[model samples]
Target: MPITDEIKKTLTDPTPLYALAGAGDLAYEKLREVPGKVEALAADRQGAQEMATAKLHEAQGLLAGAPAKVTEAVTALPTDLKVLQERAQGFALQQVARAVELAVRAKETYDELAERGKVVVDKARPQADSTQADAAQAVEPSDAAEPVAEPADPAEPIEAELLDEPPAPKKSKPRKSAPGVTE
Candidate 1:
């Protein structure tokens, strides 16, 4: 059959004809929708361009003013630092003075407590001495009343146990089963 005749026959077939017609109608509807879509996109593009241009102007303004502001801040830095240093020094001096005052108060309290301790020790010395003498006297009575036992040989029992008890378990060293083994 000739290709043109076959093509014509296929085009005339009712199922294919209906499908082609539907596709063409869809294409036409899409084409009709394009202008409105393009218009909306262009409007959006214009708004973005305007926002970018405004930001660029703002950036340019900041850049233009930056040098003078930087110079002013730099010129003021030393004086600002000096003022800050003076404040810090004043605070340091106050802290040192407060610390010294606290130390003096602590010293006075410590001295007072030490003096009180000395007085207490002085008051208790005679009593402590008398108690020691009384303990010694009481010990004298026991020394005379009982016969003293001879002191045990401290190492004898330990030596005897050492001779009798079984030896302690020995620690075994780890063995490498293979040459490449690691702990």
Candidate 2:
């Protein structure tokens, strides 16, 4: 095909036009979210400015007291570092404890699932074996011809023969008398 024909075919196809319209709709949805995003950013900027001002005031107060506390802080440095180290160790220990607890819970879950799986397999195994046996019997040829049993429908009730007696016959409807005759 010529390049001009190919270009004409592409322009005439409705799929590309539908895709453009979809893209336009998506862009419109995104544009609609812009105002909310702008408002959230403005609020965040205000919050950050307030936090910075508070930190600046706190720093100024600390600076005012620095000279008087310098010697005391210097003397307490080793104790402060030891306390920080103990806290870090405590946090690490807590994390380890949580990991152990999670492992124990996972083990319990695995064991429960394994037990349930075993029960399910055990229950299904007999039914599967019986079906296999039935299939095998069907495939085997016998010297004597025996009637093949039809698959029993569980919805139909099984008729059991009564001891030394046959089943009662089904009842028939009584004959209607003639219109003028009295029975």
Candidate 3:
């Protein structure tokens, strides 16, 4: 429980103390990168200001053209509406045709799977019949007069099986070597 002088010296040894010293050196090197960060920050701020000015000019241009654009849209409204209605009707017909095509494809797939299932059943039918016939032949009476052992009583408890088993094997201990020279 007592701390000795040797323990104190080991804990205070400088050979193991350079981790913090190396860290301090690394921090000084990283501080050299600060000027680059400041430059980048200045460039970013200038870029953001230029982008804001350009967006303001673009917004002004749009504003100047707004009245003409509105007049053009109002004049062409009836023609645009008719075109949109025709497009919508065409889209509906196309969707119906696509649905019919998909239904036909699905029915084809179903029919193909049904045919495959029928082929598999036909191939397995003879094998199943032969196996059943073999099993029936095995169940027929045997000529040999071998004695049949009666089944153990189901009423017996589980402890009876455990009691009949042999004792478990013991773990072996390691042997001790003789003192002096080891080969």
Candidate 4:
């Protein structure tokens, strides 16, 4: 007979061997549930590991892009600053030239007025000497015959002259970057 048939026959007697065999069968049935539980736990553990690996890869991708992003940002700064510096220099030179021109023109004007005053003084001196001789020859000097006051100094009048030209308008610097560009 088969071993299963022999065991069944022995179990019918309700001896220690029959009790032990029945307990073994119960243990075997319980043992069978273990594989299903182990497979489920293994699947869950594998899923968790896969998720962690995916997250790690995502983090690494971002880290890898960081250098390139930093390089782009760094490169842009100098280019922007260079353009600004150039524009500033240009504006400074323009203002300096304008100021110098204004000063030179004012000096020329002063010199011309000084020359004209010298010419007037030269013409008036001889006339004044002749008038004084005529006054001494008169029998009596009247109040109207008193010498006229000398003309106001030409230098003083020129000094008082208002500035002929308005100051140059300030130059505005151009924007370094286009409107939508990121810094």
Best by TM-score: 2
Backbone clashes, candidate 3 = 0
Full-model lDDT for every candidate = 0.76, 0.77, 0.76, 0.74
TM-score per model over all chains = 0.31, 0.35, 0.34, 0.29
TM-score pick, better of 1 and 4: 1
Q: Compared with the true structure, what per-residue lDDT tens digits does model 4 show for residues 1-183?
A: 699898898776434443344455556778999999999988799788999999999999999899999999988776677898998999999999999999999777555545554555557769999898898868578888788544387556443234565768999997699888978
Count clashing residue pairs per candidate. Answer: 0, 0, 0, 0
Question: Candidate 4: global Cα-lDDT?
Answer: 0.74
- On lDDT, the stronger of 1 and 3 is 1
Write one digit per residue (lDDT tens) for candidate 1, span 22-113. 45555677899999999998879978899999999999999999999999998877667788899999999999999999999977755555
Model 4 clash pairs are none
Q: Give a tens-digit lDDT track for model 2, residues 1-183.
A: 699999998888655444444455556778999999999989799788999999999999999999879988877676677888998999999999999999999777555555555555567779999999999988996658867444389665544323347768999999999999998
The window of 10 residues in a row where model 2 has the poorest summed lDDT is: 155-164
Task: Write the number of the candidate with greater TM-score, choosing between 1 and 2.
Answer: 2
Across 1-183, the per-residue lDDT of candidate 3 in tens digits comes to 356978988887643334444444456778999999989988799788999999999999999999999999988777677898998999999999999999999777555555555555567779999999899878875668556544377666666567689999998998777897575
Give candidate 2's TM-score: 0.35
In model 1, the Cα lDDT at residue 137 comes to: 86
